[model samples]
Target: MSMSGDPVLERVRAIEDDFADAMSRMYTVGNELATLRARLETEASPAQWTPVAEPAAPPTPAAATAAPQPSPVPTAPAGLVTPPPPAHAPAYAPAAVPPPARPLPPAEPWWQRDGVVAKILAVVGATITLIGVAFLLALAIQMGFFGPVARVTSGALLAMGLVGAAALVRRREAGTVGALGLAATGIATAYLDVLAVTRIYDWVPLAGGMVIAGLIALGGVLLARAWDSQLLAVVAVLGVALMAPFVGLDHARLTGAFLLVLTIATWPAQVGRRWWALELARVVPTGLFLAALALAQERTAVPVVLALGLAVLVVGTTVAGTRSERLPLQLGALVPVGVMPVWSAGVAAPDRWVGTALLVVATCLLLLAAGLVVHREGTAPQHRVPEIALAAAGVTSLTAAPRAVDGGSLAIVAIVGVALVWAVAALVLRQRSVLLVAWGLGVIALLGSLALLPYVVLRSQAGDVGPRHLVTAVLLVALLVVTARASDRIIPATAPVLSRALLALAVVSTGGAVVVSGVLLGQLLDDPRGGFTAGQAGATVVWMAAAALLLLRGLRGSTIAVPAGLTLAAASVVKLLLFDLAFLGGLARVVSFIVAGLLLLGMGAGYAQALERSRREGTDRTPPGPPPGPVDNPTAPTPIPPTV
Candidate 1:
């Protein structure tokens, strides 16, 4: 290509050739460097040991004067005698000097490094200190050594002393175990004191006590930040959690509010630090508190409102705080947001309005996730973290849809609509995440229909169905049709198997719909037994018709359609012979068998004619060849006649 004499192309090709040569040289040099380093190490080790047969020692000053110096080379000038090599120099040829080896740091044991031991000791010491203080106070109280005021005053003094001691210790040895342990003990003691003030003595009300405890926890958080210790921050968060029960054992609302406030206070601690443990410390207690409230059969409205606020705060902070690379935190943060709808559906009374509200919540969550995906992509242009988060939120929220709705049929209808919406969105946007959500929602709808769909039509025939029943059947049928038709477009080109499965489902759903409609029509005319029999008979004809259509499609050169058509045709024959023959009677029975037989006969005849026409067309496309014979070549010489 470069030989075409284009100067610019020739120059580009020359540059590419130069680049290839340079890369080859680079690899060769790297291998040489490694070999030289290994040789240097091997030679240096032998040089350090004394030789078995040592060379003669150097001459002394007196012997050097006595010894005769070596004569210069005969070719050299008389005044220019060559200097001798050093006694220590090797006899072999000189080589290039190896680069200085980099010095490595001395290794240390794991427990001895990174203050691991200190952290362990600090955690253990804090636990022991708190437990010891509890036992001493209990013993003193049991022995009647101190009154209520004395006990409260003593606890306050002890907490203050511990805090002061922590400050002094940290001033001397900043970030040491002693300071951390003392600080954790002080914060916990302060929290316990507040709890005692609220619960044991009722000196301060629950609200005031909680406020004071929150302040102390905040102080501990500030200290942890100043000291730059994750453990201290975790301890601060856990302090408040540990004291929750004592402060509001019987007060669910107060306990929830306290935990909510604690979560808010700890939100800032997670700001540059991605402290997952600290996050879990706050989340776990709130989860447990909500669980307790639910199990107690208490009025959970207040607590639920508070939990939602906490969830919102955590989710918003997590999204706003991190980038796409930090998706685990973002996904973990979504747990509560995902659980809220389900929790609401489970705890709230079954009502249409409640169901609608929960569905709205789920929708909003999906929308929020979508917005995050767009915003993150537009701003940062990163990997598929946002899409993953979107998928997760979609799955959780969609799972809750059935539970959120009032009834199974309504739920199926709602999910089918969602599936259709996502499917169309996938068709429009062509996002893999959107396509996956569509696929997942379809499966959800199918599963929901497993039990409810059959009953839906049955109830409708019983005159118990309303608009919901008709809407469900219509939406479900529409969903199946739309998904199947657009599967190749919406599904990725790599997933041919999934695309085929959707098509199969479409066939099954369409046939079932036709048969169900027949039964429904007969039922409307006040014929149950006859309607069922006729429905089966009608189904056989419909299946045959579908098979014929598929076969026609196959004739247009579709490999998939051919097998599918054949399978459907086989299924139709089976249904006609077994089901229709066993169930139908009167004109329905006679007409079903005869119509099916005629359709099958026509299909077979059409198939044979199609093959014949295809072969005829192929034959006409090529003219008949002449009979094989030896022929004289146009360029053959007259000598060929002599040879013959």
Candidate 2:
């Protein structure tokens, strides 16, 4: 270790000494720099500045304590000084230039500079650790030594810890630790309260213990607010404490109460409007409800939680969608929508019908409201309300309608009628989705109506035409006509040719429906099993003849009349061949054939006569007046050309 023995080693030691000395001076200069920074902070203003240098000579007693003039350079680089003037310099000196500004210090990360990450880890770790410690405490109390005093001791600890945390928050010294401490206290309180509630043979009333747990959370909220964003984490933990009941309690009402508390705790923070609160609100309630639903022994919990959660989700989603928070709202709403359909499917019989109707109605109303609110609050595209409403209704109907169909005719008719009514209303209101649905259902309805006639005939033949059946048919027909007329406005622009063809079809279908029903009504009064008989076929033939001749007469009113006449004549031929040939015999069959044939012949003659009369009337109309009569009196001599 002796330096004298090796010369090179001595030189190395000398260099080390120099480096050490240089570092020591750097430390000294840094301290001086910190002092200067402190002084500058107190002394600086627009009109004042601290002096960077002192005069060489000491001030006289009279001049002591007076302010010094500011130097041209407020601060100089370390180890440099103002240079003395040269002997040959001019007497008048120009103004001195200022020094370069100091470089700003690099900013420290929050975790490194302010202990943010450490504080979060400390508080959350402490809270989780406390729960384990509380179990130990509970275990110690369970042993014979201190079982009676366990509640008193744990309650005292919770109160003391909360008091200390509140004091820290109040002093503004706790940062995240205060909120975490508060949350840990809440977690401990929850453990004790739940234990008491479950082990009810103990002395403490369950309700009183729950009140204490609530107070713990309430105190946490107030303290957390003082800790800035720490309050959000605190609120979330409080939500977890509230969710504890969902795990251990079998009471359905308590689950609801727990969820409600969780909902309030997860509400958007009023202070600074903590943005994460929105996401928490969406998630925490769902988690609570799901946990409650999962743990419940009672079937009633499903419906109750579903209804409550749906209410919250609906308001939240609408608010969220209105605010352009679409993805979260969509994700939040999807769960309930999926679950509801499955729930509706699982419901049995009469209640199932009620549930399905509610689902459909709810879907429609939600869609309509959402579309309107979005359209009103935002710039939704045209037809948004109806399109979304109809689509949603269709989805709901598909799930609900098949079950309804399984319920029999009344169910089928009721569901179909509802869809029809909504479709018609949608069409009348200029909703394109409804218009499309209306037309589709119209086709179905038309086919359904045709199929129904035979059933109606069979029933009436068996004496089944009561007043109720008659009334139902009348209502059904009225609704169909209303639906058709409502869609009539779009005729001109939407394939006028096809639209006219549809109108013709509608006309033919309606007339045929009336014909069948009216003829069947008379038969019901006359005989129990009267179906397509000779007299009925003959009556139908005469009805067709009247329709054909009437169309021929009204050809001037509509181009469709000619086709209508031909259609009626063809119907007459079909009755003669099918009904009269198959069913009727003897005099009845002969009369039917005679009546049908005569009707067809008369229809053809009438059409021909109408066409001839129209052609003759066209020929008698005025002509063009003989081409101006050859330029008039060539006699006037023609004034010849005037002289220029």
Candidate 3:
């Protein structure tokens, strides 16, 4: 590569070339040797006749005296001969051979190599061109440079021309950035042109203009579908969505209608495509527009209907698809649908009737979830959709129950009842996620239910415990127990952490239920002398009794029961010593001590008996002797051995 060639450099180049030739000759000689060996082996096969051994005759004197002639030197084949280094070349030690070259890295993917840059540039260029067209239309209108008809005609003609250009470009280069970009821009331009005709020029009525706009949006969707381009579909939807407010001109009804029309127009694109971006483009704008309408406190019949219809359409399309989609996609589709009803009930209507309607909607969603569970057939996690539906149903019920009921206590009871229903449904369906949803709802409702119960059971009066409180507590206890059982069935034992947590919840709920029932019993008894203290003492007795039962179960060979029994026993002791000793007095205190002592004594006696029985059984199962073996006293046994 060096042009200013020194003599040493030239000599080095000559040496390199000579080395290359030598290596080539060495390889060629090796190959020739291999070929000759193969040919020799083929000719000397076992099938060929070989001479037998024979006795040798006496050697002649001349033959013995003559020395063996020198063997001739073998020459290499003509082309394989390696040339010697030139005499003029400097004599030097041999250089170390260089390492082999490293292979090149893999090439970037084609889309990353060029397509991304092209798409970005095309979309930006299209946006800029649309902005320019808008400015031109505005300038023409401001300057009165042309009459209304001429302006409308020019804009419409320009939009049509762009659409034609899109078709031509697509025909030439389908699925390219230029085609998608052009189609999106043209569709947006046509919508804008239609808007101008209806609003600015008054050449078309609002109704006619809306119809034309919807058709334009629908046409864009159809073109995207034909092209099979998600990017174009999303762009087209977004383009129309961005311009929807301009068409509606701040009229809430018109805006909601336009949004509803857009959603309907874009619905077909999402049928089986799983085009999440396109779905988001359709849903987000519609949801946001409706939210704005709700905030403005406009008459919301249109918004409410649109929200409900959109939710049903989304769920139906997603669930009806034959292909398995991801759980996140299914859940994402439901999120907007779930949140929209709050505004409808609270701000738009603010009436019990609307709340009742929401309850009905919740019931319907639950029914759909049940139907999905019944009809679905696959190993896939289709159950997750129903799980999410149950969660949404829980939220809807919680929101509606307060409005539907007259009293706070009744509302709390209703929420707890709803949670219990979800838990039961989950148990029936045998789905883990549904079970988790049930537990989550139950826990939340339980927190609300805590307000209905007296915080300190022993401090409350007899009147504090009501049927509603007792019912709510009972429902919560059942809900937790059901969900815990469901978790055991639906969740694999491999997930030890979740299983343990559910078990803990079940145990806690059981203990709480005992205390609650004791408190309620004392209230029902209407003790004339300090029923509260009596109730506290009774709770301690119940605790000790529950602990004894757990210990007995543990004694019967249940591994999990041992630790639980120990923990409950310790808690019972602590409550009896610290709480009952300080709170109870008179006969109540004496009775509590006596009962706790008896329970402890019985538990200990039962445990000891169980251990003794186990040891006895183990002894009975063992052989009477260690086996027939060597005598323990070997020397003493010699007397008997003599007889043998």
Candidate 4:
């Protein structure tokens, strides 16, 4: 803000700074190119010039014939071949030079040449034959024929392989063969390494075996570096990984050691290694992480706390890597960091793992929201991921809560809490689309909690239609109505149509509940007949009176009251025609008619009085003008005011 605290101008200044820097960079590049071009011109090599030789006259026929029958000089190697005659003597000496030794047959590269298939077959055949021979030698050693010399034989083979590799490299033609020899030597040495580790395992401890394996891996790295071959390095490390478990440690130790080895190997790739290693190493950390997590799960005392600490470390490390420009490592670190907490929670509380996982996810999503709002790069993407995650997490937590928690009421409360959180976040975040959804889900949750509390959670007191039931019903109904009634406040002003829709919903919801409950209560208290009766007709009158009351409220400026009242009147009419006439006795029928008639009369009188009042107040009054018949007279009058 440059001490002025004006963020908009600060943003503009940053953009301008970037633009200026870009232009300056471009200008600098242009100057460098121009300077390089000038220098190149100054230092360019001189063009060679040769005196143009006059076209030599074609040799005369007699001289051509006379040219000592260029006897096919017996073909000789280049050094022995006759030299061409000097240009000055060429006319006479043309026949003295053997035609330039037939252009050496264009040397054919073996790969494209006809023999390539044969070479491949030979390499394959030799590899198979060697395998067979090695098998037989091993069998011989097993039979005790060469038991004393087995190690010596293997050592000799490795030494011979090294010598051959060296010879191939020195000749600079090793290409594929040297790579094979180096790999084969590593393989041969690997067995000896295993045997040596086996000896160490017998005497020292597990660490000794690990050291032996590490040494073998170290050899691979050294050889790969020396020979400049990634394949060998990969082979070397993979061999150690495959062999480590066979050293006879317990399953736990084996898994741990293996993960440790892989973790160490992952670093080279993470810190900017080349193609093959990077590709191979990319999978290493992922494998180790999963395996370690699995192992943790199996352990009775999984180090969940340690895992959390490491999760923090992972995040911090990634941040540091980004600051230091280790982008690949930074990207790699997210996987383990993300998975660790989830895995730890699962391991730490397997029975309620899902709930724990959901809680963790919800927490992370909120953190994302906070980060989105607070990060210096203020909402660049305006992403909705956190919002979406929040919703999903809420649902997951609710779904998991029932099974994990013992108290249904508490679970209900949590669901309600989550729903409210979503609704509030949507509003606070100014995500209008989320507003309606949040409200809807919140309504559902509130309804569920209210509906379930009496039946499922408080089933012992279910039969009594007491305050608990009434309160719960009221709360649920109020929530539904209020969501619709206050939608204008919840929904943005731009969505007037949606706001109106919510209002309509409120009217329907509240009005329907009022009519149904009023009817039910009337029947319950008076008739108790379980079907239509005189009370039903009474219920009809009650609805009509309720409608009249709403009309009065509407006249007092409550817009929703008008439709609600009208709807009540309609419902009452339907009930009188459909149910009351069908079931009510003669007396009930007579009373129903009288009550309905009186309600209608009162409604009419109320409407007429309201309209008359409006007229008296001049709001419904029109200005007096000469009746329509006096059009010509109106034309002769004064011009009307524009406001009119």
Candidate 5:
């Protein structure tokens, strides 16, 4: 344990330290190799390999001669290796390889770099700054900071905002800051202008500042297109809104017209497989606006304007049809026909002659046009407007005809002939209700004339009965026939009700006619020579009986029952009155009262039964027969005969 013995501890400590250093050097070399391998794997290529350098030392005799020493032991090869014996070698010594320098990481792209964050922040700050400035400008304008100068200033601000927005949209390179700043400035200016214009005028401000705003918006839209920007659509929408107030003003016509033109121009934007609805929505409003304007004014220009509007409507409808390939537009094109009637009504003179003639002509033309439209469209059933109009025209024309000839005699025969033909035709071709009703009324009118003309002539000769008598008789008979026909047709299948209605009407008309005739007879009796003879009275009674029989048969569901019953009833009433005057003498009064009461009772009972039967049958008793056929229900469904 002296100085020589202490050397052993020192040597042991040194050996341990050397071993530790060698392990450290080996670990460091291994880490570098692993890193290189990873880099080579990531960027797999032959460029990573390099040739090994030759050693500086020459092999000694022992090394060269030693059986080709096993390849120099590699540190941490597949398995562990023990060190050579100290007796064969001087000592174990550690060797270290210099560490490989790491390559710098690839630089980040500009967008992902820190500089981008700064740029974004700068843009946001600029946008906020621009928005704040605009807000302050608007506040200043509102406060009248520049008085009239405010207007120019505001206009300039709007122009600048619009230009800036355009530039931002064009320079796609300008990040979010430029875009936001532009949008805020443009929108704010437009809003301020809109406010200023609205304040100046109560409703429509399209004339002043709003116009400028609209122009700016339009510019934005164009700029956006030029720059391939989406902002244009937004600006265009704002422009449309700005122009909306102008639609309410009289002078806004120009603005409205402009908008319409713009809409038409932009219609292509809506062109696509799926944009039909949007396209329609876009174009229809312009047409509607024009139509409203045309309707609101009263100047002479109104007609021309309306005509232009009609043209626009037609064109718009046509375009919409082409674009959407839908039938609604085609159907809607017929709406202008309704307008013509309104115009005709407005222009019609109060004088019956002129108005009647004009109406007849207009109606005829309308009927022809409607027919053409229906034919062109090939719409069936619902397209009966022409037939309906023709029927209306026929009836109206008949109504306008002079009731009495120049001789003051009623033109009963002529009127009856016309009415009969019309009624028959209407019955044969019953497509439209109006036509049917019109023709039916015409027939009733004719029948009424035939029944009453004789009485009128008789009264005229006697100078007793006035126009009032003729009018009352006509009214009563017409009402009877109309009500009877309407009830029958409307309740076709309800046989009992229809039959009863016919019978009831027959009884009423017959009985009423008889009563009226009896009164006339009594007045005649006051004059001895005026009294009817016995034969006449008998004939009258026979006529009355015949009429009653016809009515009874009608109640049995005969198709011809109503007309036949009405005719017989009329004849019978005439006969009854004649009989009373000729044979009843002083009993005429009693006979008339009794007959009238019986007739009333009969009619009331029949009507009640008919209504009850109709209720049981689950049908309306009011008459309305089949749409097309005879006035009565045809037993068979007759095919429509071809027209000549």
Candidate 6:
């Protein structure tokens, strides 16, 4: 209140007040401008006006005005002086006439409004209305209000009329109406035709129905292009519907082929505008074709179907790669390649081998391509999918080839070898954990094949050095070496599951070898005690026990002791079988029980030890140094050296 007494203080107060007032005014102006800008930008067609004509010079008063009046005397409040008005004040009177008002433009149609909520309501209303109409039509058809032919004819005509009306409507509304109408018509047509086909002319009625459906769909497509609507999407849905009837029919093969060709031919016509529809169109027809081919029990179409699928996949992947760069598309492209092995497994003997070889080559090529893609564009995750697919394809083909070809024992060995090499190469180059695990699995599979196949092929001719025992010994050693070398790479805690799987494979293979040996070779040998006799059953048990011990020590995680223990327990079974045939039954049962008990105890102890060691190590390494020293004196130092 007394700031005027100090000049510096008074000046500073004045400056501060002025600054505050200026900032307040600035903020107000900024807020007003921002609000106006937002309102203007949101308008669909923001308004701007041009001058129609320059303002007419203010009308000159006719000749002279009435006599000029004298100015009033100025008044001021008690403490203020009144300022004089400017000298350039106008001397004339006010104008008599007013300016004309501008006329407003016409209101927009309701459907074309910029309000999102209103538009959404309209779309929902239209969809509901269409559904109601479809339901009514279906009810009318079922009620037989008109003769069967009359109902069909009237429904078709009504659909056509609705489509025509939709085309003439506004473009925005046309899409919704056209799509709904086309879809309804398609469903109705398919239902009626399918009923007629099954009940009346048996199978031949399908051909005529398909032709009609095809024509109607084509009409929809043409109308869509002409009217610039999304009717093609509806047309695709129609095509799929028409194909469904034939899907269940016995002539699925023929029908599928026809639809597939038709869809392919129509694809180019629908390239840019309706890509999702085009993709759906291609997928449905191709899927039907494959299904039909499979159901027909014909091997010849396998190659043709696979080749066609590959073509579609390549084109689809290329489009996706260029347009979107999504990983799913790249993965989708590899699906055909993945399925090729399954298809090849069904072909004739000679063709199957050729097909398997083709698949392997194709898989390798795809892997190379995926590598290139990854190298060129490091950001794309799509490239990894193809590599994964390639590995999968290799595994599938090798497994399928032997059964498909009906080849000799050595052929299975060759297939497993190929799989192992392929998997190892993938692991070495990629250093991917999934690939490494797959490689290990492939090795296990190879061992299984080698152990079982030769004895199966040799039948009664298996001699003293039959390959079964040799393969088993080699596989056991190999598994140990591989597991040992890869231990550091594999997280010890998670190795149990993988080790269990391998152990399971080993059990099945070894069990299968024993069965094959007994069935095939045991009958031929006169002495029945010559080579790899049941006497070695105990040795086999010891070998398995050793393997289990190694696994328990090396793998410090979950123990797949079940399979391991089972392997050892199986020796008792071998002993019992030999003794039963040799007429020493009671002794055999006693030895079997003893051996089984020992195996169980040994496995349990080994598993418990591993689990205890894991727990101890985990506890010892935790933070917050070992509890506390025994001494209660805070200042007293207790000295002890850390030991590893």
Top lDDT prediction, candidate number: 1
Better of 1 and 2 by TM-score: 1
Cα deviation of 486 in candidate 3 (Å)? 1.7
Q: Rank the candidates by lDDT, best first.
A: 1, 3, 2, 4, 6, 5
lDDT of candidate 1 over 1-644, digit per residue (tens): 45568888657655554544444344344444544655676586543332222122222334333433343111222222222445532322234456679999889889978778888888898889989999999999999998899888989999889888988898885457788889888888887788788898999988888888888888888988888877788888888887876678877678877887787777777655656677778777776676455435444466546645654665565555454444334434444543453344444534556545644554455456455643443443332345655575566556556655654557777777778777777777767677777778888877765643453234234334345544665666677666665667755564567666766676666555555565566668877556556666776888889898888888878888878889999998987887677767899999999999999999999988997888889888856798779977698565565543
User: Model 6, residue 546: what's the lDDT?
Assistant: 55
What is residue 147's positional error in candidate 5, in angstroms? 6.5
Candidate RMSDs in order:
14.3, 24.3, 15.4, 24.9, 28.6, 18.4
- Top TM-score hit: 1
Q: List the residue pairs that clash in candidate 1.
A: none
lDDT of each: 0.67, 0.51, 0.66, 0.51, 0.48, 0.49
Worst 10 residues of 4 by lDDT: 88-97
The runs of at least 3 residues in candidate 2 whose Cα sits more than 4 Å from the true structure, single-residue gaps closed, are 1-309, 312-386, 393-409, 437-481, 488-526, 531-554, 557-568, 584-598, 620-632, 636-644
Order of candidates by TM-score, top first?
1, 3, 2, 6, 4, 5
Residue 60 C-alpha lDDT in model 1: 35
- Deviation of model 3 at 117, angstroms: 1.8
| Candidate 4 structure quality by residue, lDDT tens digits, 196-251 | 43644354366666666676666666656666655556656666665665554354
Candidate 4 to native Cα RMSD, angstroms: 24.9
Which portions of model 1 show Cα errors greater than 4 Å?
Answer: 1-113, 173-175, 287-308, 322-331, 334-351, 373-405, 408-411, 452-474, 481-494, 622-644
Give, for candidate 3, the lowest lDDT window spanning 10 residues.
49-58
Root mean square deviation (Cα) for candidate 3: 15.4
TM-score of each: 0.72, 0.47, 0.71, 0.44, 0.36, 0.46
lDDT of 4: 0.51
| lDDT for each residue of candidate 2 in 127-173, tens digit (9 for 90 to 100) | 67667766866687678555545665665666476656646664664
Whose TM-score is higher: candidate 3's or candidate 4's? 3
